[model samples]
Target: MVGRELYRLLQCPTCNSRDLAVYAEYVLCAGCRNQYPIHKGYIDLMPRQTEFDYISKYVSEEESMGEELDYREMAPPLLAAGVRHRQIRRMLELKPTDIVFDNACGNGRFGLWNADAVGLLVGSDPAVLFADQALAEMELAQADSRRLPFVDGAFDKSLSVDVLEHFPRDVIHDYLVETARVLKVGGRVAIFSNTREMSPIQPIINISKRLGKFFVKQGVYDFEREARRKSDHIKDLKTWDDVEAALVEAGLKPVKVVFWNSVFTSFVEHVLMKLGESLIAKRRTAKAASATVLTDEAVNASAGAQREIVARRAMRRHLTKSSPIYWALYTITLLMELDLWLFGWMRTGPYFVLAEKVEGRYVPAPLPAEE
Candidate 1:
């Protein structure tokens, strides 16, 4: 059951009120009279409750993302794609009394990773399909970024990781506004998102790029498949200035901004990390293909996503912390950190921002009804 402390923080995602009633199987907001369901502990508090493609992608039919994996473990940097989970955690400077929100908390993994150290970690996202499997330290909610279910000034800190690229261009400001609204005045938010901009030193990056493609041609990595998947959900890769403007409009002042993926990071993430995950994904996909028969639903549904999930799980299984291979790749990741020290000031993609709620500038907006 969801605890009383969480209930005190609950507000109607639609009306933004604390007049909420906790029931056996659902939470009802008296202000809006909207009942959000809780199935075996997964709470769905999204205002619109519309069908979204994220459900298909993140929640595979064969195996869920966190089904067999330890929820608190971070992916080895070589297979983490570009999340920078360790770096993000360091930047947050979490306090024991802090209550943080894992905004757009994909699978609630980050929250799980940090839950024990903080007062509370509430994860809210469009998809809460994975929350049923979540451990007790964190609370997960199915809520929209543009219209959060929490009341005004509810949290001390927020972390928005790998989420901006997925939001549409038009709603980026709305998302920030909601973020600012939920944070107490002077509360900080750690944001990790990408800009459309590429590095000024593109020629140097292309050196590794060429070698990466050569490896792809030799069947060592699926560069084309990775590119397609990377491009699929990216709706808004706004420039850094646009991001700053959006934050200001939302009443969040940028305290620190760091440009990442400059040189070593570009090579490691785009080339090396892709190679590692693709190789693991390929072998795992092949094994699954040979072992299992597909149902009609599997054929019609997001089969590619399911395969990728299986592959990701295999990568985690093999890259256990005790494995020397994990440490070896981690050393490369440590070297990759040099880019942050050397070239972070330069203009480049996937920036990290620490913004503070400035107070009195943003107005909360209602979520549009499902079309």
Candidate 2:
């Protein structure tokens, strides 16, 4: 289980050289004499920490939060994980012989979960701390999205899910260029990202926030802060036109675009999310008040117990047939399915862009057929 496939596929990030040989504890690049360590069964290919401060900070915070919250899980009752995964599979058209790359692959769930379907799957992220689970399934490396560590035309397909939103506006073009650089001709790149437009349920969400403010005054909840923290977007792509232009600038030819997650579904998902947060907060507050003195062990024990409770609650919410949360999620998923079928062409929530790398200018290759 030496991950020989990855050894053959990856290049030295420092020199863009493929003269790599696997040592017992590291990969040695004969061209540049740079040795990258293999820690916890995954390669550390990041040349330096030049552009990953935000990712480092965010991953540190998320690690401290423990395993109670799953970062990959989408908001319940809207945009279910299963639904999204299905859409991704269709968009990428993954094949048994395809070699795929996941850039900015936070947590690496998309590639890890689909390991059986593809020949060689590789996931890279600036934040390597959250990559343990993904490493178990595919070859993972801590590498920058703006400077991918693979040689040119190494991959048959590439994907970036909910990752571009975190990139600064100025560097997005560079990121896309790096993504295109690593893909083989006819290889497609699929991106799911948020734009500047508010979800269709902004008015309802505003009214709900106003009502939630009264709860805050009564010392019952802080829904507004919770919502704001979750909805924070670092970079804004203004519109679909902007997204397309960026891809084109990076030598990618856009082929398809679709907007999904309807207004009604998003509104309901937020309401449920706020309610869940309030409930968890209340429980934590009660536990804090009941404990007269707190020690590190006591705090850890309390957290462990809370995680168990939350996991059980989530299981019931998603699995139990009679549970209201389960039914609500099912009904919303069905409705959203219908919405996509009927009006997905209209501009709405976040959109997915499918594009292919422009090969002629960069390297000679036959033109890809239209989708």
TM-score of each: 0.81, 0.76
The most accurate candidate by lDDT is 1
TM-score of 1: 0.81
What C-alpha lDDT, on a 0 to 100 scale, does residue 145 get in candidate 1?
A: 79
Error of 1 at 157 (Å): 0.4
lDDT of 1 by residue, 158-237 (tens): 99887887666556767788888889999999988887888888788778888777876876654443443344356364
lDDT of 2 by residue, 172-267 (tens): 766888888888877899888878766564575366556555655775534432232244366446777778877877788998887774544444
**Candidate 2 error regions (>4 Å):** 48-56, 59-79, 199-232, 273-332, 363-371
